[model samples]
Target: GGPAKGEGQATGGCPVYSHPAQLTDNRNCVLCMTCLKACPHRSVEFNLRPPGIELWTTHQPMGHEVALLFLLWGAVLVHRLPEIAERLQLPQLLARFDYHALATVVLLAAPGGVAWGLYQLNRLGNPCLQGRPFVQVAYGWLPMVLLSSLAHYLTLGLTEAGRIIPVTLATFGLATAGPIWVAHPAVIAFLQAVSLLLGALLSILLIQRIAQQPWLRLLPLHGMTVGMTVCLYQLIV
Candidate 1:
């Protein structure tokens, strides 16, 4: 409904999905500081930093960011569930819509929960942090997590991404050649192993750098890192 008399007009907005051209047309933006200067709360600041080092730092994330990562992890699992189901020969019950819900919950509470718990383990090993939230240090562990994600997605992209193009094009009365390229199973396997092992090594180094404690004090969490990597290796390879 339109605004009543004496009410201010509603601001017009465009849906990103409906008007993707708006996002693609960045010509109107001239790097002007108008928005930053116009903010009432003065919450904006800018700084420069070295690339990619922040992911390995011990700095914790906000509560919502940690929660966001949990949800993202769940989404990632949902995206990969078909492959997972195929490998495990999941029961027919998984064909139901509820399976996505179940898988998301399981992924969030199980693997994602373990990653969050490691922040507590870090706290326990320190004992100096009494009142701080665990979310702070949790995302510090994301370098390996994100790297493994890249590796996983890269394999899928190289092997499977091209297949959809022909089907989509055919719907529009177009024809295409065979799949762009399909790497050999052995080659994909080799790349997957390299990515997983490299991620594992990076995770170990991240733990050592961020934990800054003797192994005995942080053994459990370190073990969690190693175990997670091993599970990932088994799952993918």
Candidate 2:
């Protein structure tokens, strides 16, 4: 039988039952392959698409989803907190709080606060813009959030990942001093810079597409994207 009524079913059956094309926007899909295995017509399939394409497409984002996007953005910054605190000489000021607690606050507050400020600036520059500015612009930053995190993790993967060989051998009591391959720090830094640049470009494009506003009004968000790219570059590299 087809997907049941009032069960959150839409135009297609993909477990979540959202239309197949809309799966990019459906956060509930767990990719369990239930529909792929069960479809009688064999019409279910996967297609390769550009990352962050969904950010520019039509989808009504919920409040929680928007909030989560900010959280994800903030998470990328959370990893650099130690270096940040050190450079700014904030250890003494922050000594009263636990490290984990401070990180939690940064994770929860930083991105949202920045976004809110940018949204207000954008609205101030163009008062005619309509709708909830925060929700409207939230998804536009997804590419930045995702690629920055990827770039951050790429450093670990490139440098520390080689240790898995010797570490695994040690775990099995077969310790050896044979050389293992690790990418050069310079190479990793170059790649991280490239990743951030690409993310910033995609973010600018997505913001333009999503906002549909004049360049003058969009300047604040564009600046924010560029600023974030620079900040992440400094933090990671």
Candidate 3:
């Protein structure tokens, strides 16, 4: 017979009804791949698509999920905090506190604080949005957040990933030439910049689509997104 039924829906071991779009809902998925393995007909298939498309399309994030996004954003900031602090001439201030403790605070607070402040400005500028949940509009930042994280890590991937070749060869006591094909610093920087630019553009478009308000009213949110992109570009590149 076919797959067993649970309340009339196929019991495919998916908590979210095996809905492709809902799979993009990160909070509900543990990435276990049980649905794929459990499907008797091998009908489940994973396809690649544009990154962050679900943010503007079908992902309806809740308040806690929005908080999780900010947490991830804060992690990006924490990863670059040393450079940021030095650039801001806060090295002395940073010295007084334990590095791990400070990073903990930044990881917990920075993004959420900035997001909350921007949310207030958004509400003030767009009075019509006062009744809407902040989480609803905050989804607009999803693209920027995801792309910025990717760009931040791109540096390590481009510069360090090539070392695995030599490292793997040396691990077996074999002679090695060197890193196979590391990207030039300039090229890596350029790619990082391009990634941030794309993220900023997508973020602005998403904000406009989500808000559906006058351009003037949307300026604060747009400014926030652009400002973050600029800050991340400076830190990462």
Question: What overall lDDT goes with each candidate model?
Answer: 0.61, 0.76, 0.75
Task: List RMSD in Å for every model shown.
Answer: 9.3, 5.2, 4.8
Rank by lDDT, highest first. Answer: 2, 3, 1
Compute the lDDT of residue 202 as modeled in candidate 1: 69
- lDDT score, residue 101, model 1? 70
* Per-residue lDDT over 140-217 for candidate 1, one digit per residue giving the tens place of the 0 to 100 score: 456556756766787777777757777677778788554566778788878877886786676666556555556566
TM per prediction: 0.62, 0.81, 0.75
Clash count, predicted structure 1 = 3
Q: Candidate 3: list runs displaced more than 4 Å.
A: 1-58, 93-100, 125-131, 176-179
| Winning model by TM-score | 2
Best candidate, lDDT: 2
Alpha-carbon error at 112 in model 2, in Å? 1.5
lDDT of 2 by residue, 125-202 (tens): 667677345786778888888889889999789877878888888888898654688998899999899889998998
Residue pairs with colliding backbones in model 3 are none
Worst 10 residues of 3 by lDDT: 1-10
